[model samples]
Target: MSWKTFPKVELHLHHEGAAPPAFIRGLAKEKSVNISGVFAEDGSYVFTDFVHFLSVYEAATQVLKTPEDYHRLTLAVLEQSAANGVVYSETFLSPDFCGNRDLSAWREFLHAIREAADQAERDMGITLRGIVTCVRHFGPDKAKQTARCAAETAGDWITGFGMGGDEGQGRQGDFAYAFDMAREAGLRLTTHAGEWGGPQSVHDALDDLRVERIGHGVRAIEDPALIERLVAENIVLEVCPGSNVALGLYPDVASHPIARLRDAGVKVTVSTDDPPFFHSTMTQEYEQLEQAFGWDEEDFAALNRSAIDAAFCTEDTRARIIKRLESQ
Candidate 1:
């Protein structure tokens, strides 16, 4: 069955990473910026590996320099998500990219993005929320600045704080202070773990950072004890199977641990971490999972229910999204 119109709740999209290659190319040409190295002859992003992907990702983001640029980006991203039936989505926004962790500048960028999001909601009936994120590779000091930006803007719109970027950079504990600051400001927390780092990384994120959810916590399958703990603690995993396979973490979707993790009673939700970068969409992810694991509409509906439960949005927003999901 085609999953194109199936309502989905996404919780782990990266704002900059979601930029479509064609959009980036257009922006680059308009700004006279050269980012031809990041794209292939077919106009899709090209990267040798995860680390190289980061470089290419950053190179592509170089053309997005102003609040207006982010405004356009937010609209373009939401249009893609809406097309694929993503009813509600929470996107990771890095102050490092927005305004170099400057509070005032970040606020300006946030305003533009929020304005676009509001417009999208009214026009397309797709809700968008922001999660302020710190780039792990940028180090702990910069993370504190990003966290401060998050704290200053802690509200209904900016609901959560997370850490993204290379999980191999530093231990999750190294950024405890930043996480603590965000927590103090009443922000929900989540961080990248178990994707590049081992199962131990998931433990560190839980024991140290105290996050309620984990981004790409697929490696937990390698440790039975960790899987049990995740279930016991009810920590949601934002599993991006396509992103994992695209980065060569797994050979294909059939080899991905999402099905195993779900069968083991772990709360797993689907997301397109960087859809364009991974050449994936919400509908495409559903199709792949269905083909690989024989997941039917009921399975996907359950996944969507789990996703809305784990989403960082307010109760009112959650209820509205749930209503839409049920109506569909």
Candidate 2:
């Protein structure tokens, strides 16, 4: 049972970040955008660190100025993900990128992306759902607008709300107003924490934002009480092992706390946070986990089941996906 054949679910992916370098390059060529430094001569996103990665990410996004651009991006990303054995994925979509904080433009962008997602599900057998995310580094006032857009568009395809960006920018409580708005809209919640902020950031996200999931929560392992609380509450951590390693969050995959956190009874699921940027896919993620932690087929299956259970989808859709997993 090779990892490439394993049925996997991803819960912490960014829509723009998942765009393959070649896809971004093609989009740039079509739009005649001068995003030359976005990719290297070898065709990979070039960045020095997380800060520069965000800059390159935004530079590549400049080519995606129209709704059609996002549609093409969705198709390209999902096609690649399907080829890598991703059966289900929930990707972060930002209004800042799509609409520039204008509700009208956001609606148009969302429509195009959702249409492409529907087609991807039909053609690629990969179910795609969106998590409307507010860019934290963009400031709290702007995040409120992004949250408003997400709250207004709580549909079957757009199932969740999240915050992404520089975790070190401000306190999580600063974004409480936006999270409250999403909560009122009945959207499932998650937030980026513990990547750069450590255990206290994870605590703030849990206590203030009240998210059902935490993105890149590997740092919670440092706080024994926080780990206990997470396990008791059944909050899932959308752990991206390869991304952490690539970003220098951990020195190596062997030093990652994913196995330790799972052993502590904290619900954990695997994901490729930014596939192309991190130079990983679902197949590579599972393969690396197997090599590092001695995980087997049953372990992978259990991880998939945990992801499905934690997924924010309709019961009918969940049942359908569960059946597909069982059949596999």
Candidate 3:
């Protein structure tokens, strides 16, 4: 009955966004940065809307000033994720945050993060892979630099490229050059879409960005044709039900589109988009799905299988995790 003990895989987590508020607060205090307004007395992030949440997310990252800081952060995040039974995860890592879009500077942070992840794999039962991500609102030009950073190290640790942030950005096509660069480097692609924009945005991401998976593509349910297209294409959706409720994208867990998307023959996987910010853990995500939709262990296992299939990791790694999942 304790979902916390169930093996799980996360595919759409954000690196800095997963930072514990206490972790950020500690870093802020060490540097004398006054960001107390970002958190409530309960030590939870506060934001009235999505745009404000984006600003708050960036403000919190200012505390992570060095690669060592990211090393510490990676350990902390992995510990929390492991405790919640996340056996494997692929997190979104923005080069913009690592080094402000500088390839040389980003390398240092990537090294630190990868080192920490390796250590965590040894210490905890969690395995992590990084996806070099571009912040969409930062514009297409900046995305090109992020793609460069991803392409430079697209082999093992950094296996994927993605875009996150404001979904209302110009258009997915505007970032074609960056996606092309990552594609040429053989990086698997994904993009944040349909969470904020309508189904048309999801369509643009498919036609233009040509992503294999989508982050928060729940809104695609709005267009039946789009839904059918998604089913036909067999694109996976990284659905974060808890995040949807927390961000007011849905009124409650029961109203989330995850079940509908699944029943419609769409491949879907669950993740905590920003765990701490939404006051959710992987255990809580599983519990809510069970409570809201009467899901059972088999349901969760199937979801994990879908995540493993859609994961931007090596076949060897995926097979290893699938073996562990079967043991559960």
**TM-score for each model:** 0.99, 0.99, 0.99
Residue-level lDDT for 19 in candidate 2: 94
When summed lDDT is taken over every stretch of 10 residues in candidate 2, the lowest stretch is 1-10
Between candidates 2 and 3, name the one with more favorable lDDT: 3
lDDT by residue for model 1 over 124-224, one digit each (tens)? 98999999999999999999999999999999999999999988787999999999999999999999999999899999999999999999999999999
Cα-based lDDT at residue 57, candidate 3: 93
Global fold similarity of model 1 (TM-score): 0.99
lDDT of 1 at 117: 100
lDDT of each: 0.96, 0.92, 0.94
Worst 10 contiguous positions by lDDT, candidate 3: 34-43
Tens digits of per-residue lDDT for model 3 on 240-288?
A: 9999899999999999989999999999999999999999999999999
Superpose all Cα atoms of candidate 2 onto the true structure and report the RMSD in Å to 1 decimal.
Answer: 0.8
Q: Residue 311's C-alpha lDDT in candidate 2?
A: 98
